[model samples]
Target: MLSTYVDLAVGLVLAFLFLSLLVSGINEGLVRLLSIRSKFLWAFLRDTLDGPDRQGRSFLPAGMRDVFTALPFSRDARPRHNSMPSPAVLSPIPEGEAVAEGELTERLYERVREIDHPKAKRTSIATLPPERFALALMEFASAEPNGVQGLLDKLKAMRSPLHGHLQGIWESSAADVNRFRQQVEVWFDAEMRRLTLLYRRYVRWVVAVLGLVLTLVFSMDALEYGKTLLRDQAFREGVAAIAGGGDQGLTALKDRCTATGDSADPYRCVTEALSSPALVKIFDHALVGVAVPQNGDPQVKWNLGAWWERLISPGHWPGFVLTFAALLFGASFWWDILRRLTGIRSRAGR
Candidate 1:
């Protein structure tokens, strides 16, 4: 009886893991859809562009406030489109030195020159301190209609087509060039913080909505599955057989029953049940097509609609909520737990 209960518990956890993997995939896809990656890049650039020292002195020339622009990024925002280079463009140039990590200065200096003056001699700007790096940008932009001046001119010239997060701030700062950096910094800081909070909030909303939807779709009523295990002796026997499947790996797990922390990590039972062919049949069959009563009873086509009805029936919300709440633990947490269990179980088996 105890073994049967253990089998049931492990089976439920495995089911949760499967659901988590799918839901997490959707969550990550939504991040890309919303361009969260680009938002993060902009936030990071807000700090990097400022460099280490900024006491009312910087590399950008006088006309910079007119055309200062945020670095272009995101899947849709091509680096080659804007005067500012995108993060994605940082790559090894053939017949040249490999740009190492933490060497953004070198990469930017090399890349900007390539765009403006392809034949110019490459400089060792990457090793320079942040202060010098700023000067490098200033010098590079010093050419007629200087680089920075050219950038601002481009922004002005293409005002009709160009739209960016930094564009408005730069345009507005044209009135007060002296305090432009301070005002822009304040605005950038606030916007970045807001984006951070917004991203987190949206993620939770996605998880909750996704969890609830999956619960309804899969008939993952924790209460119902538990009740089914307890009420149906045949089902309990089948699940227990899965949990107690006779295999060398499982036997090793059993042999380690008394090993330290065995109770803390019930990997043996979980591993056996997860590997069970019967468990695979259960989930696969349920997910692929309209489900029907196992016994093919009359007036009992257990299709998606039928499950939806049962899900909305009295006392079903609690079960659905429980399932959804369990999913809030997320897939990464479960993976870490499974890894720990594997280690402890292996030690005990030895």
Candidate 2:
């Protein structure tokens, strides 16, 4: 009786885990489909360059302008990349025509003061008017027209993902002389915002439909399942036994379980201990309650009519709602919960 009880409890845990893993796999696909994580980061970078007022008013050095232009959206009306012809380009100022250091530094320092940049590196040269900041960036640009790419190459060598993005921007925008800062700002920032919202709404719909399908396929009606769980006293007791005896359960399990740890667990050894017949039984039992039609079940058919009947049947509505609600908790939530429960149960068995 005790052995049979252990089998049932372990089977229940496995079933719970199976459901969680299914949800996790679908969630991963959904995240990638929408590029949900990367969108915010790209958006943040767009805002940083465009400034709050929607103007091309950032105070970075002018030589670096090409780096920002190639990203996401650029108004570069000219042909771009290696295949296309070049548009109008900014000619670097001749060496002699360029402002001398004392003059340039003074202008830069004054501009820095106007902007009130936090780090004061040029306290000795702040005698000029605030308008020199633009002049300073332009002069800085003129002084080293080709230098920015060299620095960019060095940055690329670092192999960081963000620097790689910067390099890509530079390559795409280097010959793009027609589209200026304002165009890039509008495309990357304002227009991208609309696209992001629309795509996210679409993703939500996909997740809902997917959730309902998974719910029905599993025959996991929350109401019926809840009754099944409640009627089985051993099942409830099994859950409690694995859930850990308050806070000390995990600690106690660790002390007692000589063969189990985070990197290793004895539960896997159960399979090794099983005979071939026992293994077959475990496998067979695992699929016993799954929704897929079984062999020779003449009554079971999943044709369009059956699907329509399932869809319209009021009896399935509560379960469908429960399933979608479970989906809202998401794969990560269930996985984490299961992981904790697993540790608790595995340790308790020791």
lDDT of 1: 0.47
Clashing pairs in model 2? none
Number of clashing residue pairs, candidate 1: 1
Candidate 2 off by > 4 Å: 1-20, 33-40, 50-209, 216-219, 227-304, 339-350
RMSD of 1: 15.5
lDDT of candidate 1 at residue 226, scale 0 to 100: 66
Weakest 10 consecutive residues, lDDT, candidate 1?
A: 71-80
Which candidate's lDDT is highest? Answer: 1
The 0-to-1 C-alpha lDDT of every candidate, in the order given, reads: 0.47, 0.41
lDDT of 1 by residue, 83-185 (tens): 3443533332212133222243333444443333221122211112333334343343343253444434433443311224335544676734334445545
Clashing pairs in 1: 141-147
Write model 2 residue lDDT over 1-350, tens digit each, in one string. 66554544444444444555576678566454433333333233223322222254322212322223332133211111122222234333223324232232232333343433222221221122323422443343444546545434433443222245444544666634222222334334544466456445544565566666666665455544444433343333443465655543343334333445444353433223222222122222121232233345534333445545655678867965765676756656655665565555545467
RMSD over all Cα atoms, model 2 = 18.9
